[model samples]
Target chain A: MAERALEIRSESHTYPIYIAAGLRHQTADILKGLGKSTFSAVLIVTDETVGPLYAEEVAASFADEQPLYICTLAAGEQSKSMETYYELMTFALNCHLDRNSVIVALGGGVVGDAAGFAAATYMRGIDYVQMPTTLLAHDSSVGGKTGINHPLGKNLIGAFHPPAAVIYDTETLYTLPEKEWRSGLAEVIKHGWIQDPELLKVIKDQWLDLSAVPVDVLNDTIRQSIQVKAEIVQLDEREAGIRAFLNFGHTLGHAIEAEAGYGTLTHGEAVAIGMDFAMKLSGKVLGSSLDSEAYNEEMIRLGYDLTIPASCEPETLLAHMKRDKKAAEQKVRFVLLQEAGVPLVRPVEDDTILDLLKEEMTI
Target chain B: MAERALEIRSESHTYPIYIAAGLRHQTADILKGLGKSTFSAVLIVTDETVGPLYAEEVAASFADEQPLYICTLAAGEQSKSMETYYELMTFALNCHLDRNSVIVALGGGVVGDAAGFAAATYMRGIDYVQMPTTLLAHDSSVGGKTGINHPLGKNLIGAFHPPAAVIYDTETLYTLPEKEWRSGLAEVIKHGWIQDPELLKVIKDQWLDLSAVPVDVLNDTIRQSIQVKAEIVQLDEREAGIRAFLNFGHTLGHAIEAEAGYGTLTHGEAVAIGMDFAMKLSGKVLGSSLDSEAYNEEMIRLGYDLTIPASCEPETLLAHMKRDKKAAEQKVRFVLLQEAGVPLVRPVEDDTILDLLKEEMTI
Candidate 1:
């Protein structure tokens, strides 16, 4: 097991991200080492699937240092919801968690989001640590962007509360299915395409097959992906400017994910398609010489369905894109990967967007 | 009309607090003058009572500056419920408000709290202007403590999101009832008792009569009261240290307010009682000659009901006091104004608190 550490700085504070295999067993010492040992109580928020697998081991890591409480939610993207968020608040209050308490987000992206949001709003914000159990969580576990989805839009309700720390235990990733591996890889690849083109080469050369990535490679991949996000977050903690670049494929990816109805497609799968579309649009609109066909083939080789679901219409996606929280004056802006490696965010005409969508539906 | 401005600086940004007559009518130009001219949309969150009285006037203040929307909740402390907060989020979404939009928290503390909370968490927070319609809101509008009450606690779910600015329209105070004046005056007096004794002299000399406060006197009083809070908040934006001093009476006052059930007694009325009790405790526990009887005499003269109503059990209040969110390891600490003007925060034993409660109940 290789141990790697990265530091992220937000406006309020600086926290460390610890990526290692078997860190779960050493959670107590790590938290103490980071000087975050005083927790009045601990609330471990894990999804139902991960609760049975890893929640107890994580709870034992506390070893009665503070009273521990567990809140398990229904698994997947659907758990990132208002009802669940509200219920988590009640549960925290009922468990006698107070200002000094720390919330342990002990599962995947959905758990991190739902639990991170709970930590964000409970008692007007409390400290929380990300104990990410899945690969998809590597992106969410950093950057302090915590939120739940609104019925009308994804992440319309949320906060930019950075976690006290991130303790990423890679051992849990072994239990993840092949689909989950593919799902998590999109954001990992996104980090490559937007920030560091070098990150893509690591995946391209050694880990094209998602499930068979080596341990040292996985640790490096997680650190590099997180470093890209952390640097963006460090520069713009509140998404004031550079952080929007992190939303490279998210402009279309979010609309596609939301229009397809949450859980219909894993976020990475939707983003993989979004990334493909962006390259194609960039070549067509920005006159970038990026090979969109080659990009599509690469995505296909990595096992992504680039085809837009017939049930999710282009018009509906356009509407959702316009409704993205970043939109001001109903302007539809996208993070276009214009030259394969370079991404730019600019407003594209609705007609141009609609035409692109219409063309995608035919395929 | 005379206008005064006070600047408040939080960790994120510095926002101005404008105290004036008819500022609501001049909102458009004022926002433009302050360099906050672009609002994609404006959502005015008022209560049912204040909505009919002043929401329309405030909305008209925008005057084609941006798309305008209003969300009116049931009036009073009951309106600060999780259900109402959730509904407000849905309404903001349905209104197509994006992150660029601003929320106008119009009306009393209830509205400021619920609406400011919505502003704080809506799309991970947006800018909000505090349009206070009640004297009680003078305290709430300044500090940027925004939240909805959990069934178990007051302001348990909230954020420390300061408003973009506070637009305090004094003209709205003209329509307030005597109970409202007395209610708001308690906080005014609290500022004097804890921070600056000069504040008490202003109220003690000219405005002892709750209903007949002259306009200039009222303006001066609001400024002084807000200054006390603004200074405290400026020093400790996140309630880290000196800010807790602002909760001088709130330790027991909040317990009493919650135990009595919200809206049972006006917040100021409850705090009035808590202040009296705090002085009493300060005298008994800290051996300070702060003159509790004179404080009681002054409060009674100001038209406050100092009686504990015989129904709110002292034991219940003790339990609620222990559950105060600031409690760590169940140790109850309170900001005690031991020497009338100087306040101190230190842990008080449960026995001492229970004994004090029992003594108060007998009276």
Candidate 2:
């Protein structure tokens, strides 16, 4: 029964993360294990892309068990809007889903986020299971953070609502493009940078290859990444203290996403660049002796474009950083890493940040 | 400082409920007491009705302590909507109100609910203070329940987020119409029915008069009502168990509102009628020997119109009841009162409920 799975025991909630191949077909059996949730209905919140591929298979898994509804959203970051969230709620309510209804977030980070947020707020939160189909979701699927993007800021409107369980099927990863896989790998790199050195070795073994990963290797890699995420989350579920370390690269990454415009760079690509800048910043501020060239080389080899577009003004990026959702008191705070597993969230002056941005981002 | 105030010690959170007159002018002083919230920015979310009367006073209370912004939504239930929620998030984000910002929900239940919901989600939940102006807010102000209505359901989307504090200024209630006072009273009676009998006696003394109550009596009554609410909320912050009792009348009341059309009857009046049906059901189902005449007399003398309108179909109301957000497994369960301080939630057979609905609702 213990088929490559680990349980995340957060401060407030404890749930399992199943890392295996073709586990999506076992949705019903897995949910029956949730002692408290006697859900009589299931709403599979999926996107046009993931829905077409796996929604039917997952829905068929619930045959005669209970009523199951599938809601297909437009695929992309745009679907994580209030309009989409409202539509999903209307659709759920229209289908007569009651309190015992469970939402199945079936897709990557975008689908997980939007669907998870819907679950967070629907009837003041209903039980939801994360059926993440991408590697980026390995990061988001563990943490209870769920939300949609506001036009002014991404994730400005959200909640810290955890899923009941995460059922990840590595088989689904086979269909993803190499760039998508590379984009997801950046977060795995982040998990390694923040917590596990063994994960770094795993990535190093693959070198620059993103074409394909053997099933067993992929499952193990996902299990390791989720373990790092689960440990951090268990320590600080609400981002009160150590959880801020999870944002190691997000501070500058979010600003770049804003300055360069979202959809211009995959989230992992920007975060990879952000981690590089944070690394250098750590060396300057915390006096950490780390090999900058090797770190840069590893990211580049992993197919991440760390080049900051010239159009992204240092001042604008700095402004975006200050306005970051994680920035308390409008201070530009970055999660600076001294080394693997040791991180600090501290405010850096605008001049210091601008100096680094100009030096690194302007080619 | 033994003022007329009580603290709510909920399972997840403990916050103060200050019940007094002229507390609006004391916003800055009250907020300084929160230990961990080093908020440098304040967003006072009020409505047109209340903002025009007190926004400037509350904003000035900040007094160079920090930056404060006021966003006034349109006054009414319609304001408790996704559009308004989105607009408020946009406004707050545009003003650069980051994670350290505090939101002041300053108005009646609508304003408190909408503003509190924004606080619950903005930057994935920030600190919020409830400055309830209406008597009805005494019920909503305590329970950490924050939400906006969807097109399909009332409060279809929300969160169980507690406030930093609830500052109830009864001086503001003086401006409220008598109808609003009576409307708020319905919840006071609900609290009394489920928890405290003393609160019921307090209301009995002021029978048939919506005009005015002395400041001392008003303050004490609100304190008692809030005390009952606090105790119940402390037991179950989320409606996992005992918190369901708080929905004694709300189960059918919500359906009546939906079927009879919202805004036709105040929330309190609909609830009062729902309580009557629940009381009668409790007698028949639980064999509780309660005087129906005395209960009916109290509501009538309290100036509540208990008529359930001829247009409401029993089957339609039954359907709505089954679809209630609180309903489990699509079963129409109700918080039926055996007597004061003894409430039991049980699912009534559709025929049983239909018979009662036909007998009582069909005038």
Task: Name the candidate that leads on TM-score.
Answer: 1
**Per-residue CA lDDT of candidate 1, range B1-363, in tens?**
224478888888898888887888876666666675487898989988889988788778676757899888998778888788889989998888877888888898889988999998888989888989889889989877999887776788999899888888888898899888888999999999988899888888988567777777887889889999988988888777988888877877777777777668878888888888788778777888887777888888888888876768877887777755454456678778768679998777788888888887786
Q: How many residue pairs clash in each candidate?
A: 1, 0
Residue B54 of model 1: what lDDT? Answer: 82
Q: Please, what are the lDDT tens digits per residue for candidate 2 over residues B156-263? A: 788888999999888999899888888899999988888898788888986436648888889989999888888888887877899899898988888898889888
Local error of candidate 1 at residue A226 (angstroms): 1.3
Question: How does model 2 fare in lDDT?
Answer: 0.85
Query: In model 2, which residue pairs have backbone atoms overlapping below 3 Å?
Result: none
- Every model's DockQ: 0.78, 0.72
Model 2, runs deviating above 4 Å: A2-4, A206-208, A310-332, A349-363, B1-4, B206-208, B307-332, B349-363
lDDT of 1 at B330: 67
Candidate 1 Cα errors over 4 Å, as ranges: A1-4, A258-264, A308-320, A323-331, A338-340, A350-363, B1-4, B255-264, B312-320, B323-332, B349-363
- The best candidate in terms of DockQ: 1
Clashing pairs in 1: A124-B158
For each candidate, what TM-score against the reference? 0.93, 0.92
